[model samples]
Target: MKNLYFLALLIGFNLSAQELPNLNLLNLEGKSVSLKNDFMEKDKIYVFSFWATWCGPCINELEEMNELQEEWKKEINIEIIAVSIDDSRTQKRVKPLVKGKEWNYNVLLDTNQDFKRAMSIVNPPYTIVVKNGKIVHIQNGYVPGNEKDLYEKIKTL
Candidate 1:
């Protein structure tokens, strides 16, 4: 029982220590925004989702997020901001692709990779849930039913 308690404490500490780095990225219109400022506040939780145009899983995850965004927002004051990791050369494709998909979430461009490196994210379809400027959850590789889990996390915040 004592070992079990120690193990649980270690897990809790590790979870709380995992943090998302501060990053500044540009929006589709070329305006700069700080991830720390834009996504977090004293009273709000932000969902920062990183994706790329070339990744099929990323596209599917964003589509799933869009479908559930409204309902999620109504229940919890959560906002999902989609960040595209496509480089500047391929940046032109982002707007049209997002538009074509009819995604209603806020979209930004991370063409310079500042955000990706800050979050230590090497793969597309990564998500970090931030609350009060601290990371609460970090997930890589999206699965079809993962949004339910995400929603539950957001609801708890």
Candidate 2:
């Protein structure tokens, strides 16, 4: 039932042309960055994967994407930004966990969930693909092979 509910949510949240929120979020190193200004490359696709330090599938999705990013970049102009939604309590674990995993993604700290609220994201492992400041695609959950589908979607943009 939980899976079904998540699926329903996922289907309902497939945003076609929503513009990204002009919100400033802190990166892991505590630098305030603007979502719109900092990531506005001419035609580059930015994959923002929202996750938390405690979510297993969230970690899995990022790990798989990390492994596949090199090959994907060879064929497309893309950047993956792993946005951590770990609030103040668990937020401290985020850095150590990221370091331990050795992920190469640009990590953004969404400590107050401003970005998540702006995006209306309900869960972790939620991914949004943005191009030219507009959200082109969104995936609400992670499965072992979902990275392939994400790659294919990015290719079409």
In model 2, where do residues sit more than 4 Å from their true spots?
1-14
The RMSD of every model to the true structure, in order and in angstroms, is 3.0, 5.0
lDDT of 2 by residue, 57-97 (tens): 99999999999999999999999999999999999999999
Regions of candidate 1 where Cα sits further than 4 Å from its true position:
1-15, 18-20
TM-score of 1: 0.85
Instruction: Give residue 9's lDDT in candidate 2 (0 to 100).
Output: 79
Judging by TM-score against the true structure, name the best candidate: 2
Q: Please give the lDDT score at residue 73 for candidate 1.
A: 74
State candidate 2's TM-score: 0.90
lDDT of 1 by residue, 1-157 (tens): 9999999999868766766566777776778887766676676778889998899999999999999998887887788899999997878899999889999978888888887887779898999888877778888899899889988877777
Query: How well does candidate 2 score on lDDT at residue 126?
Result: 98
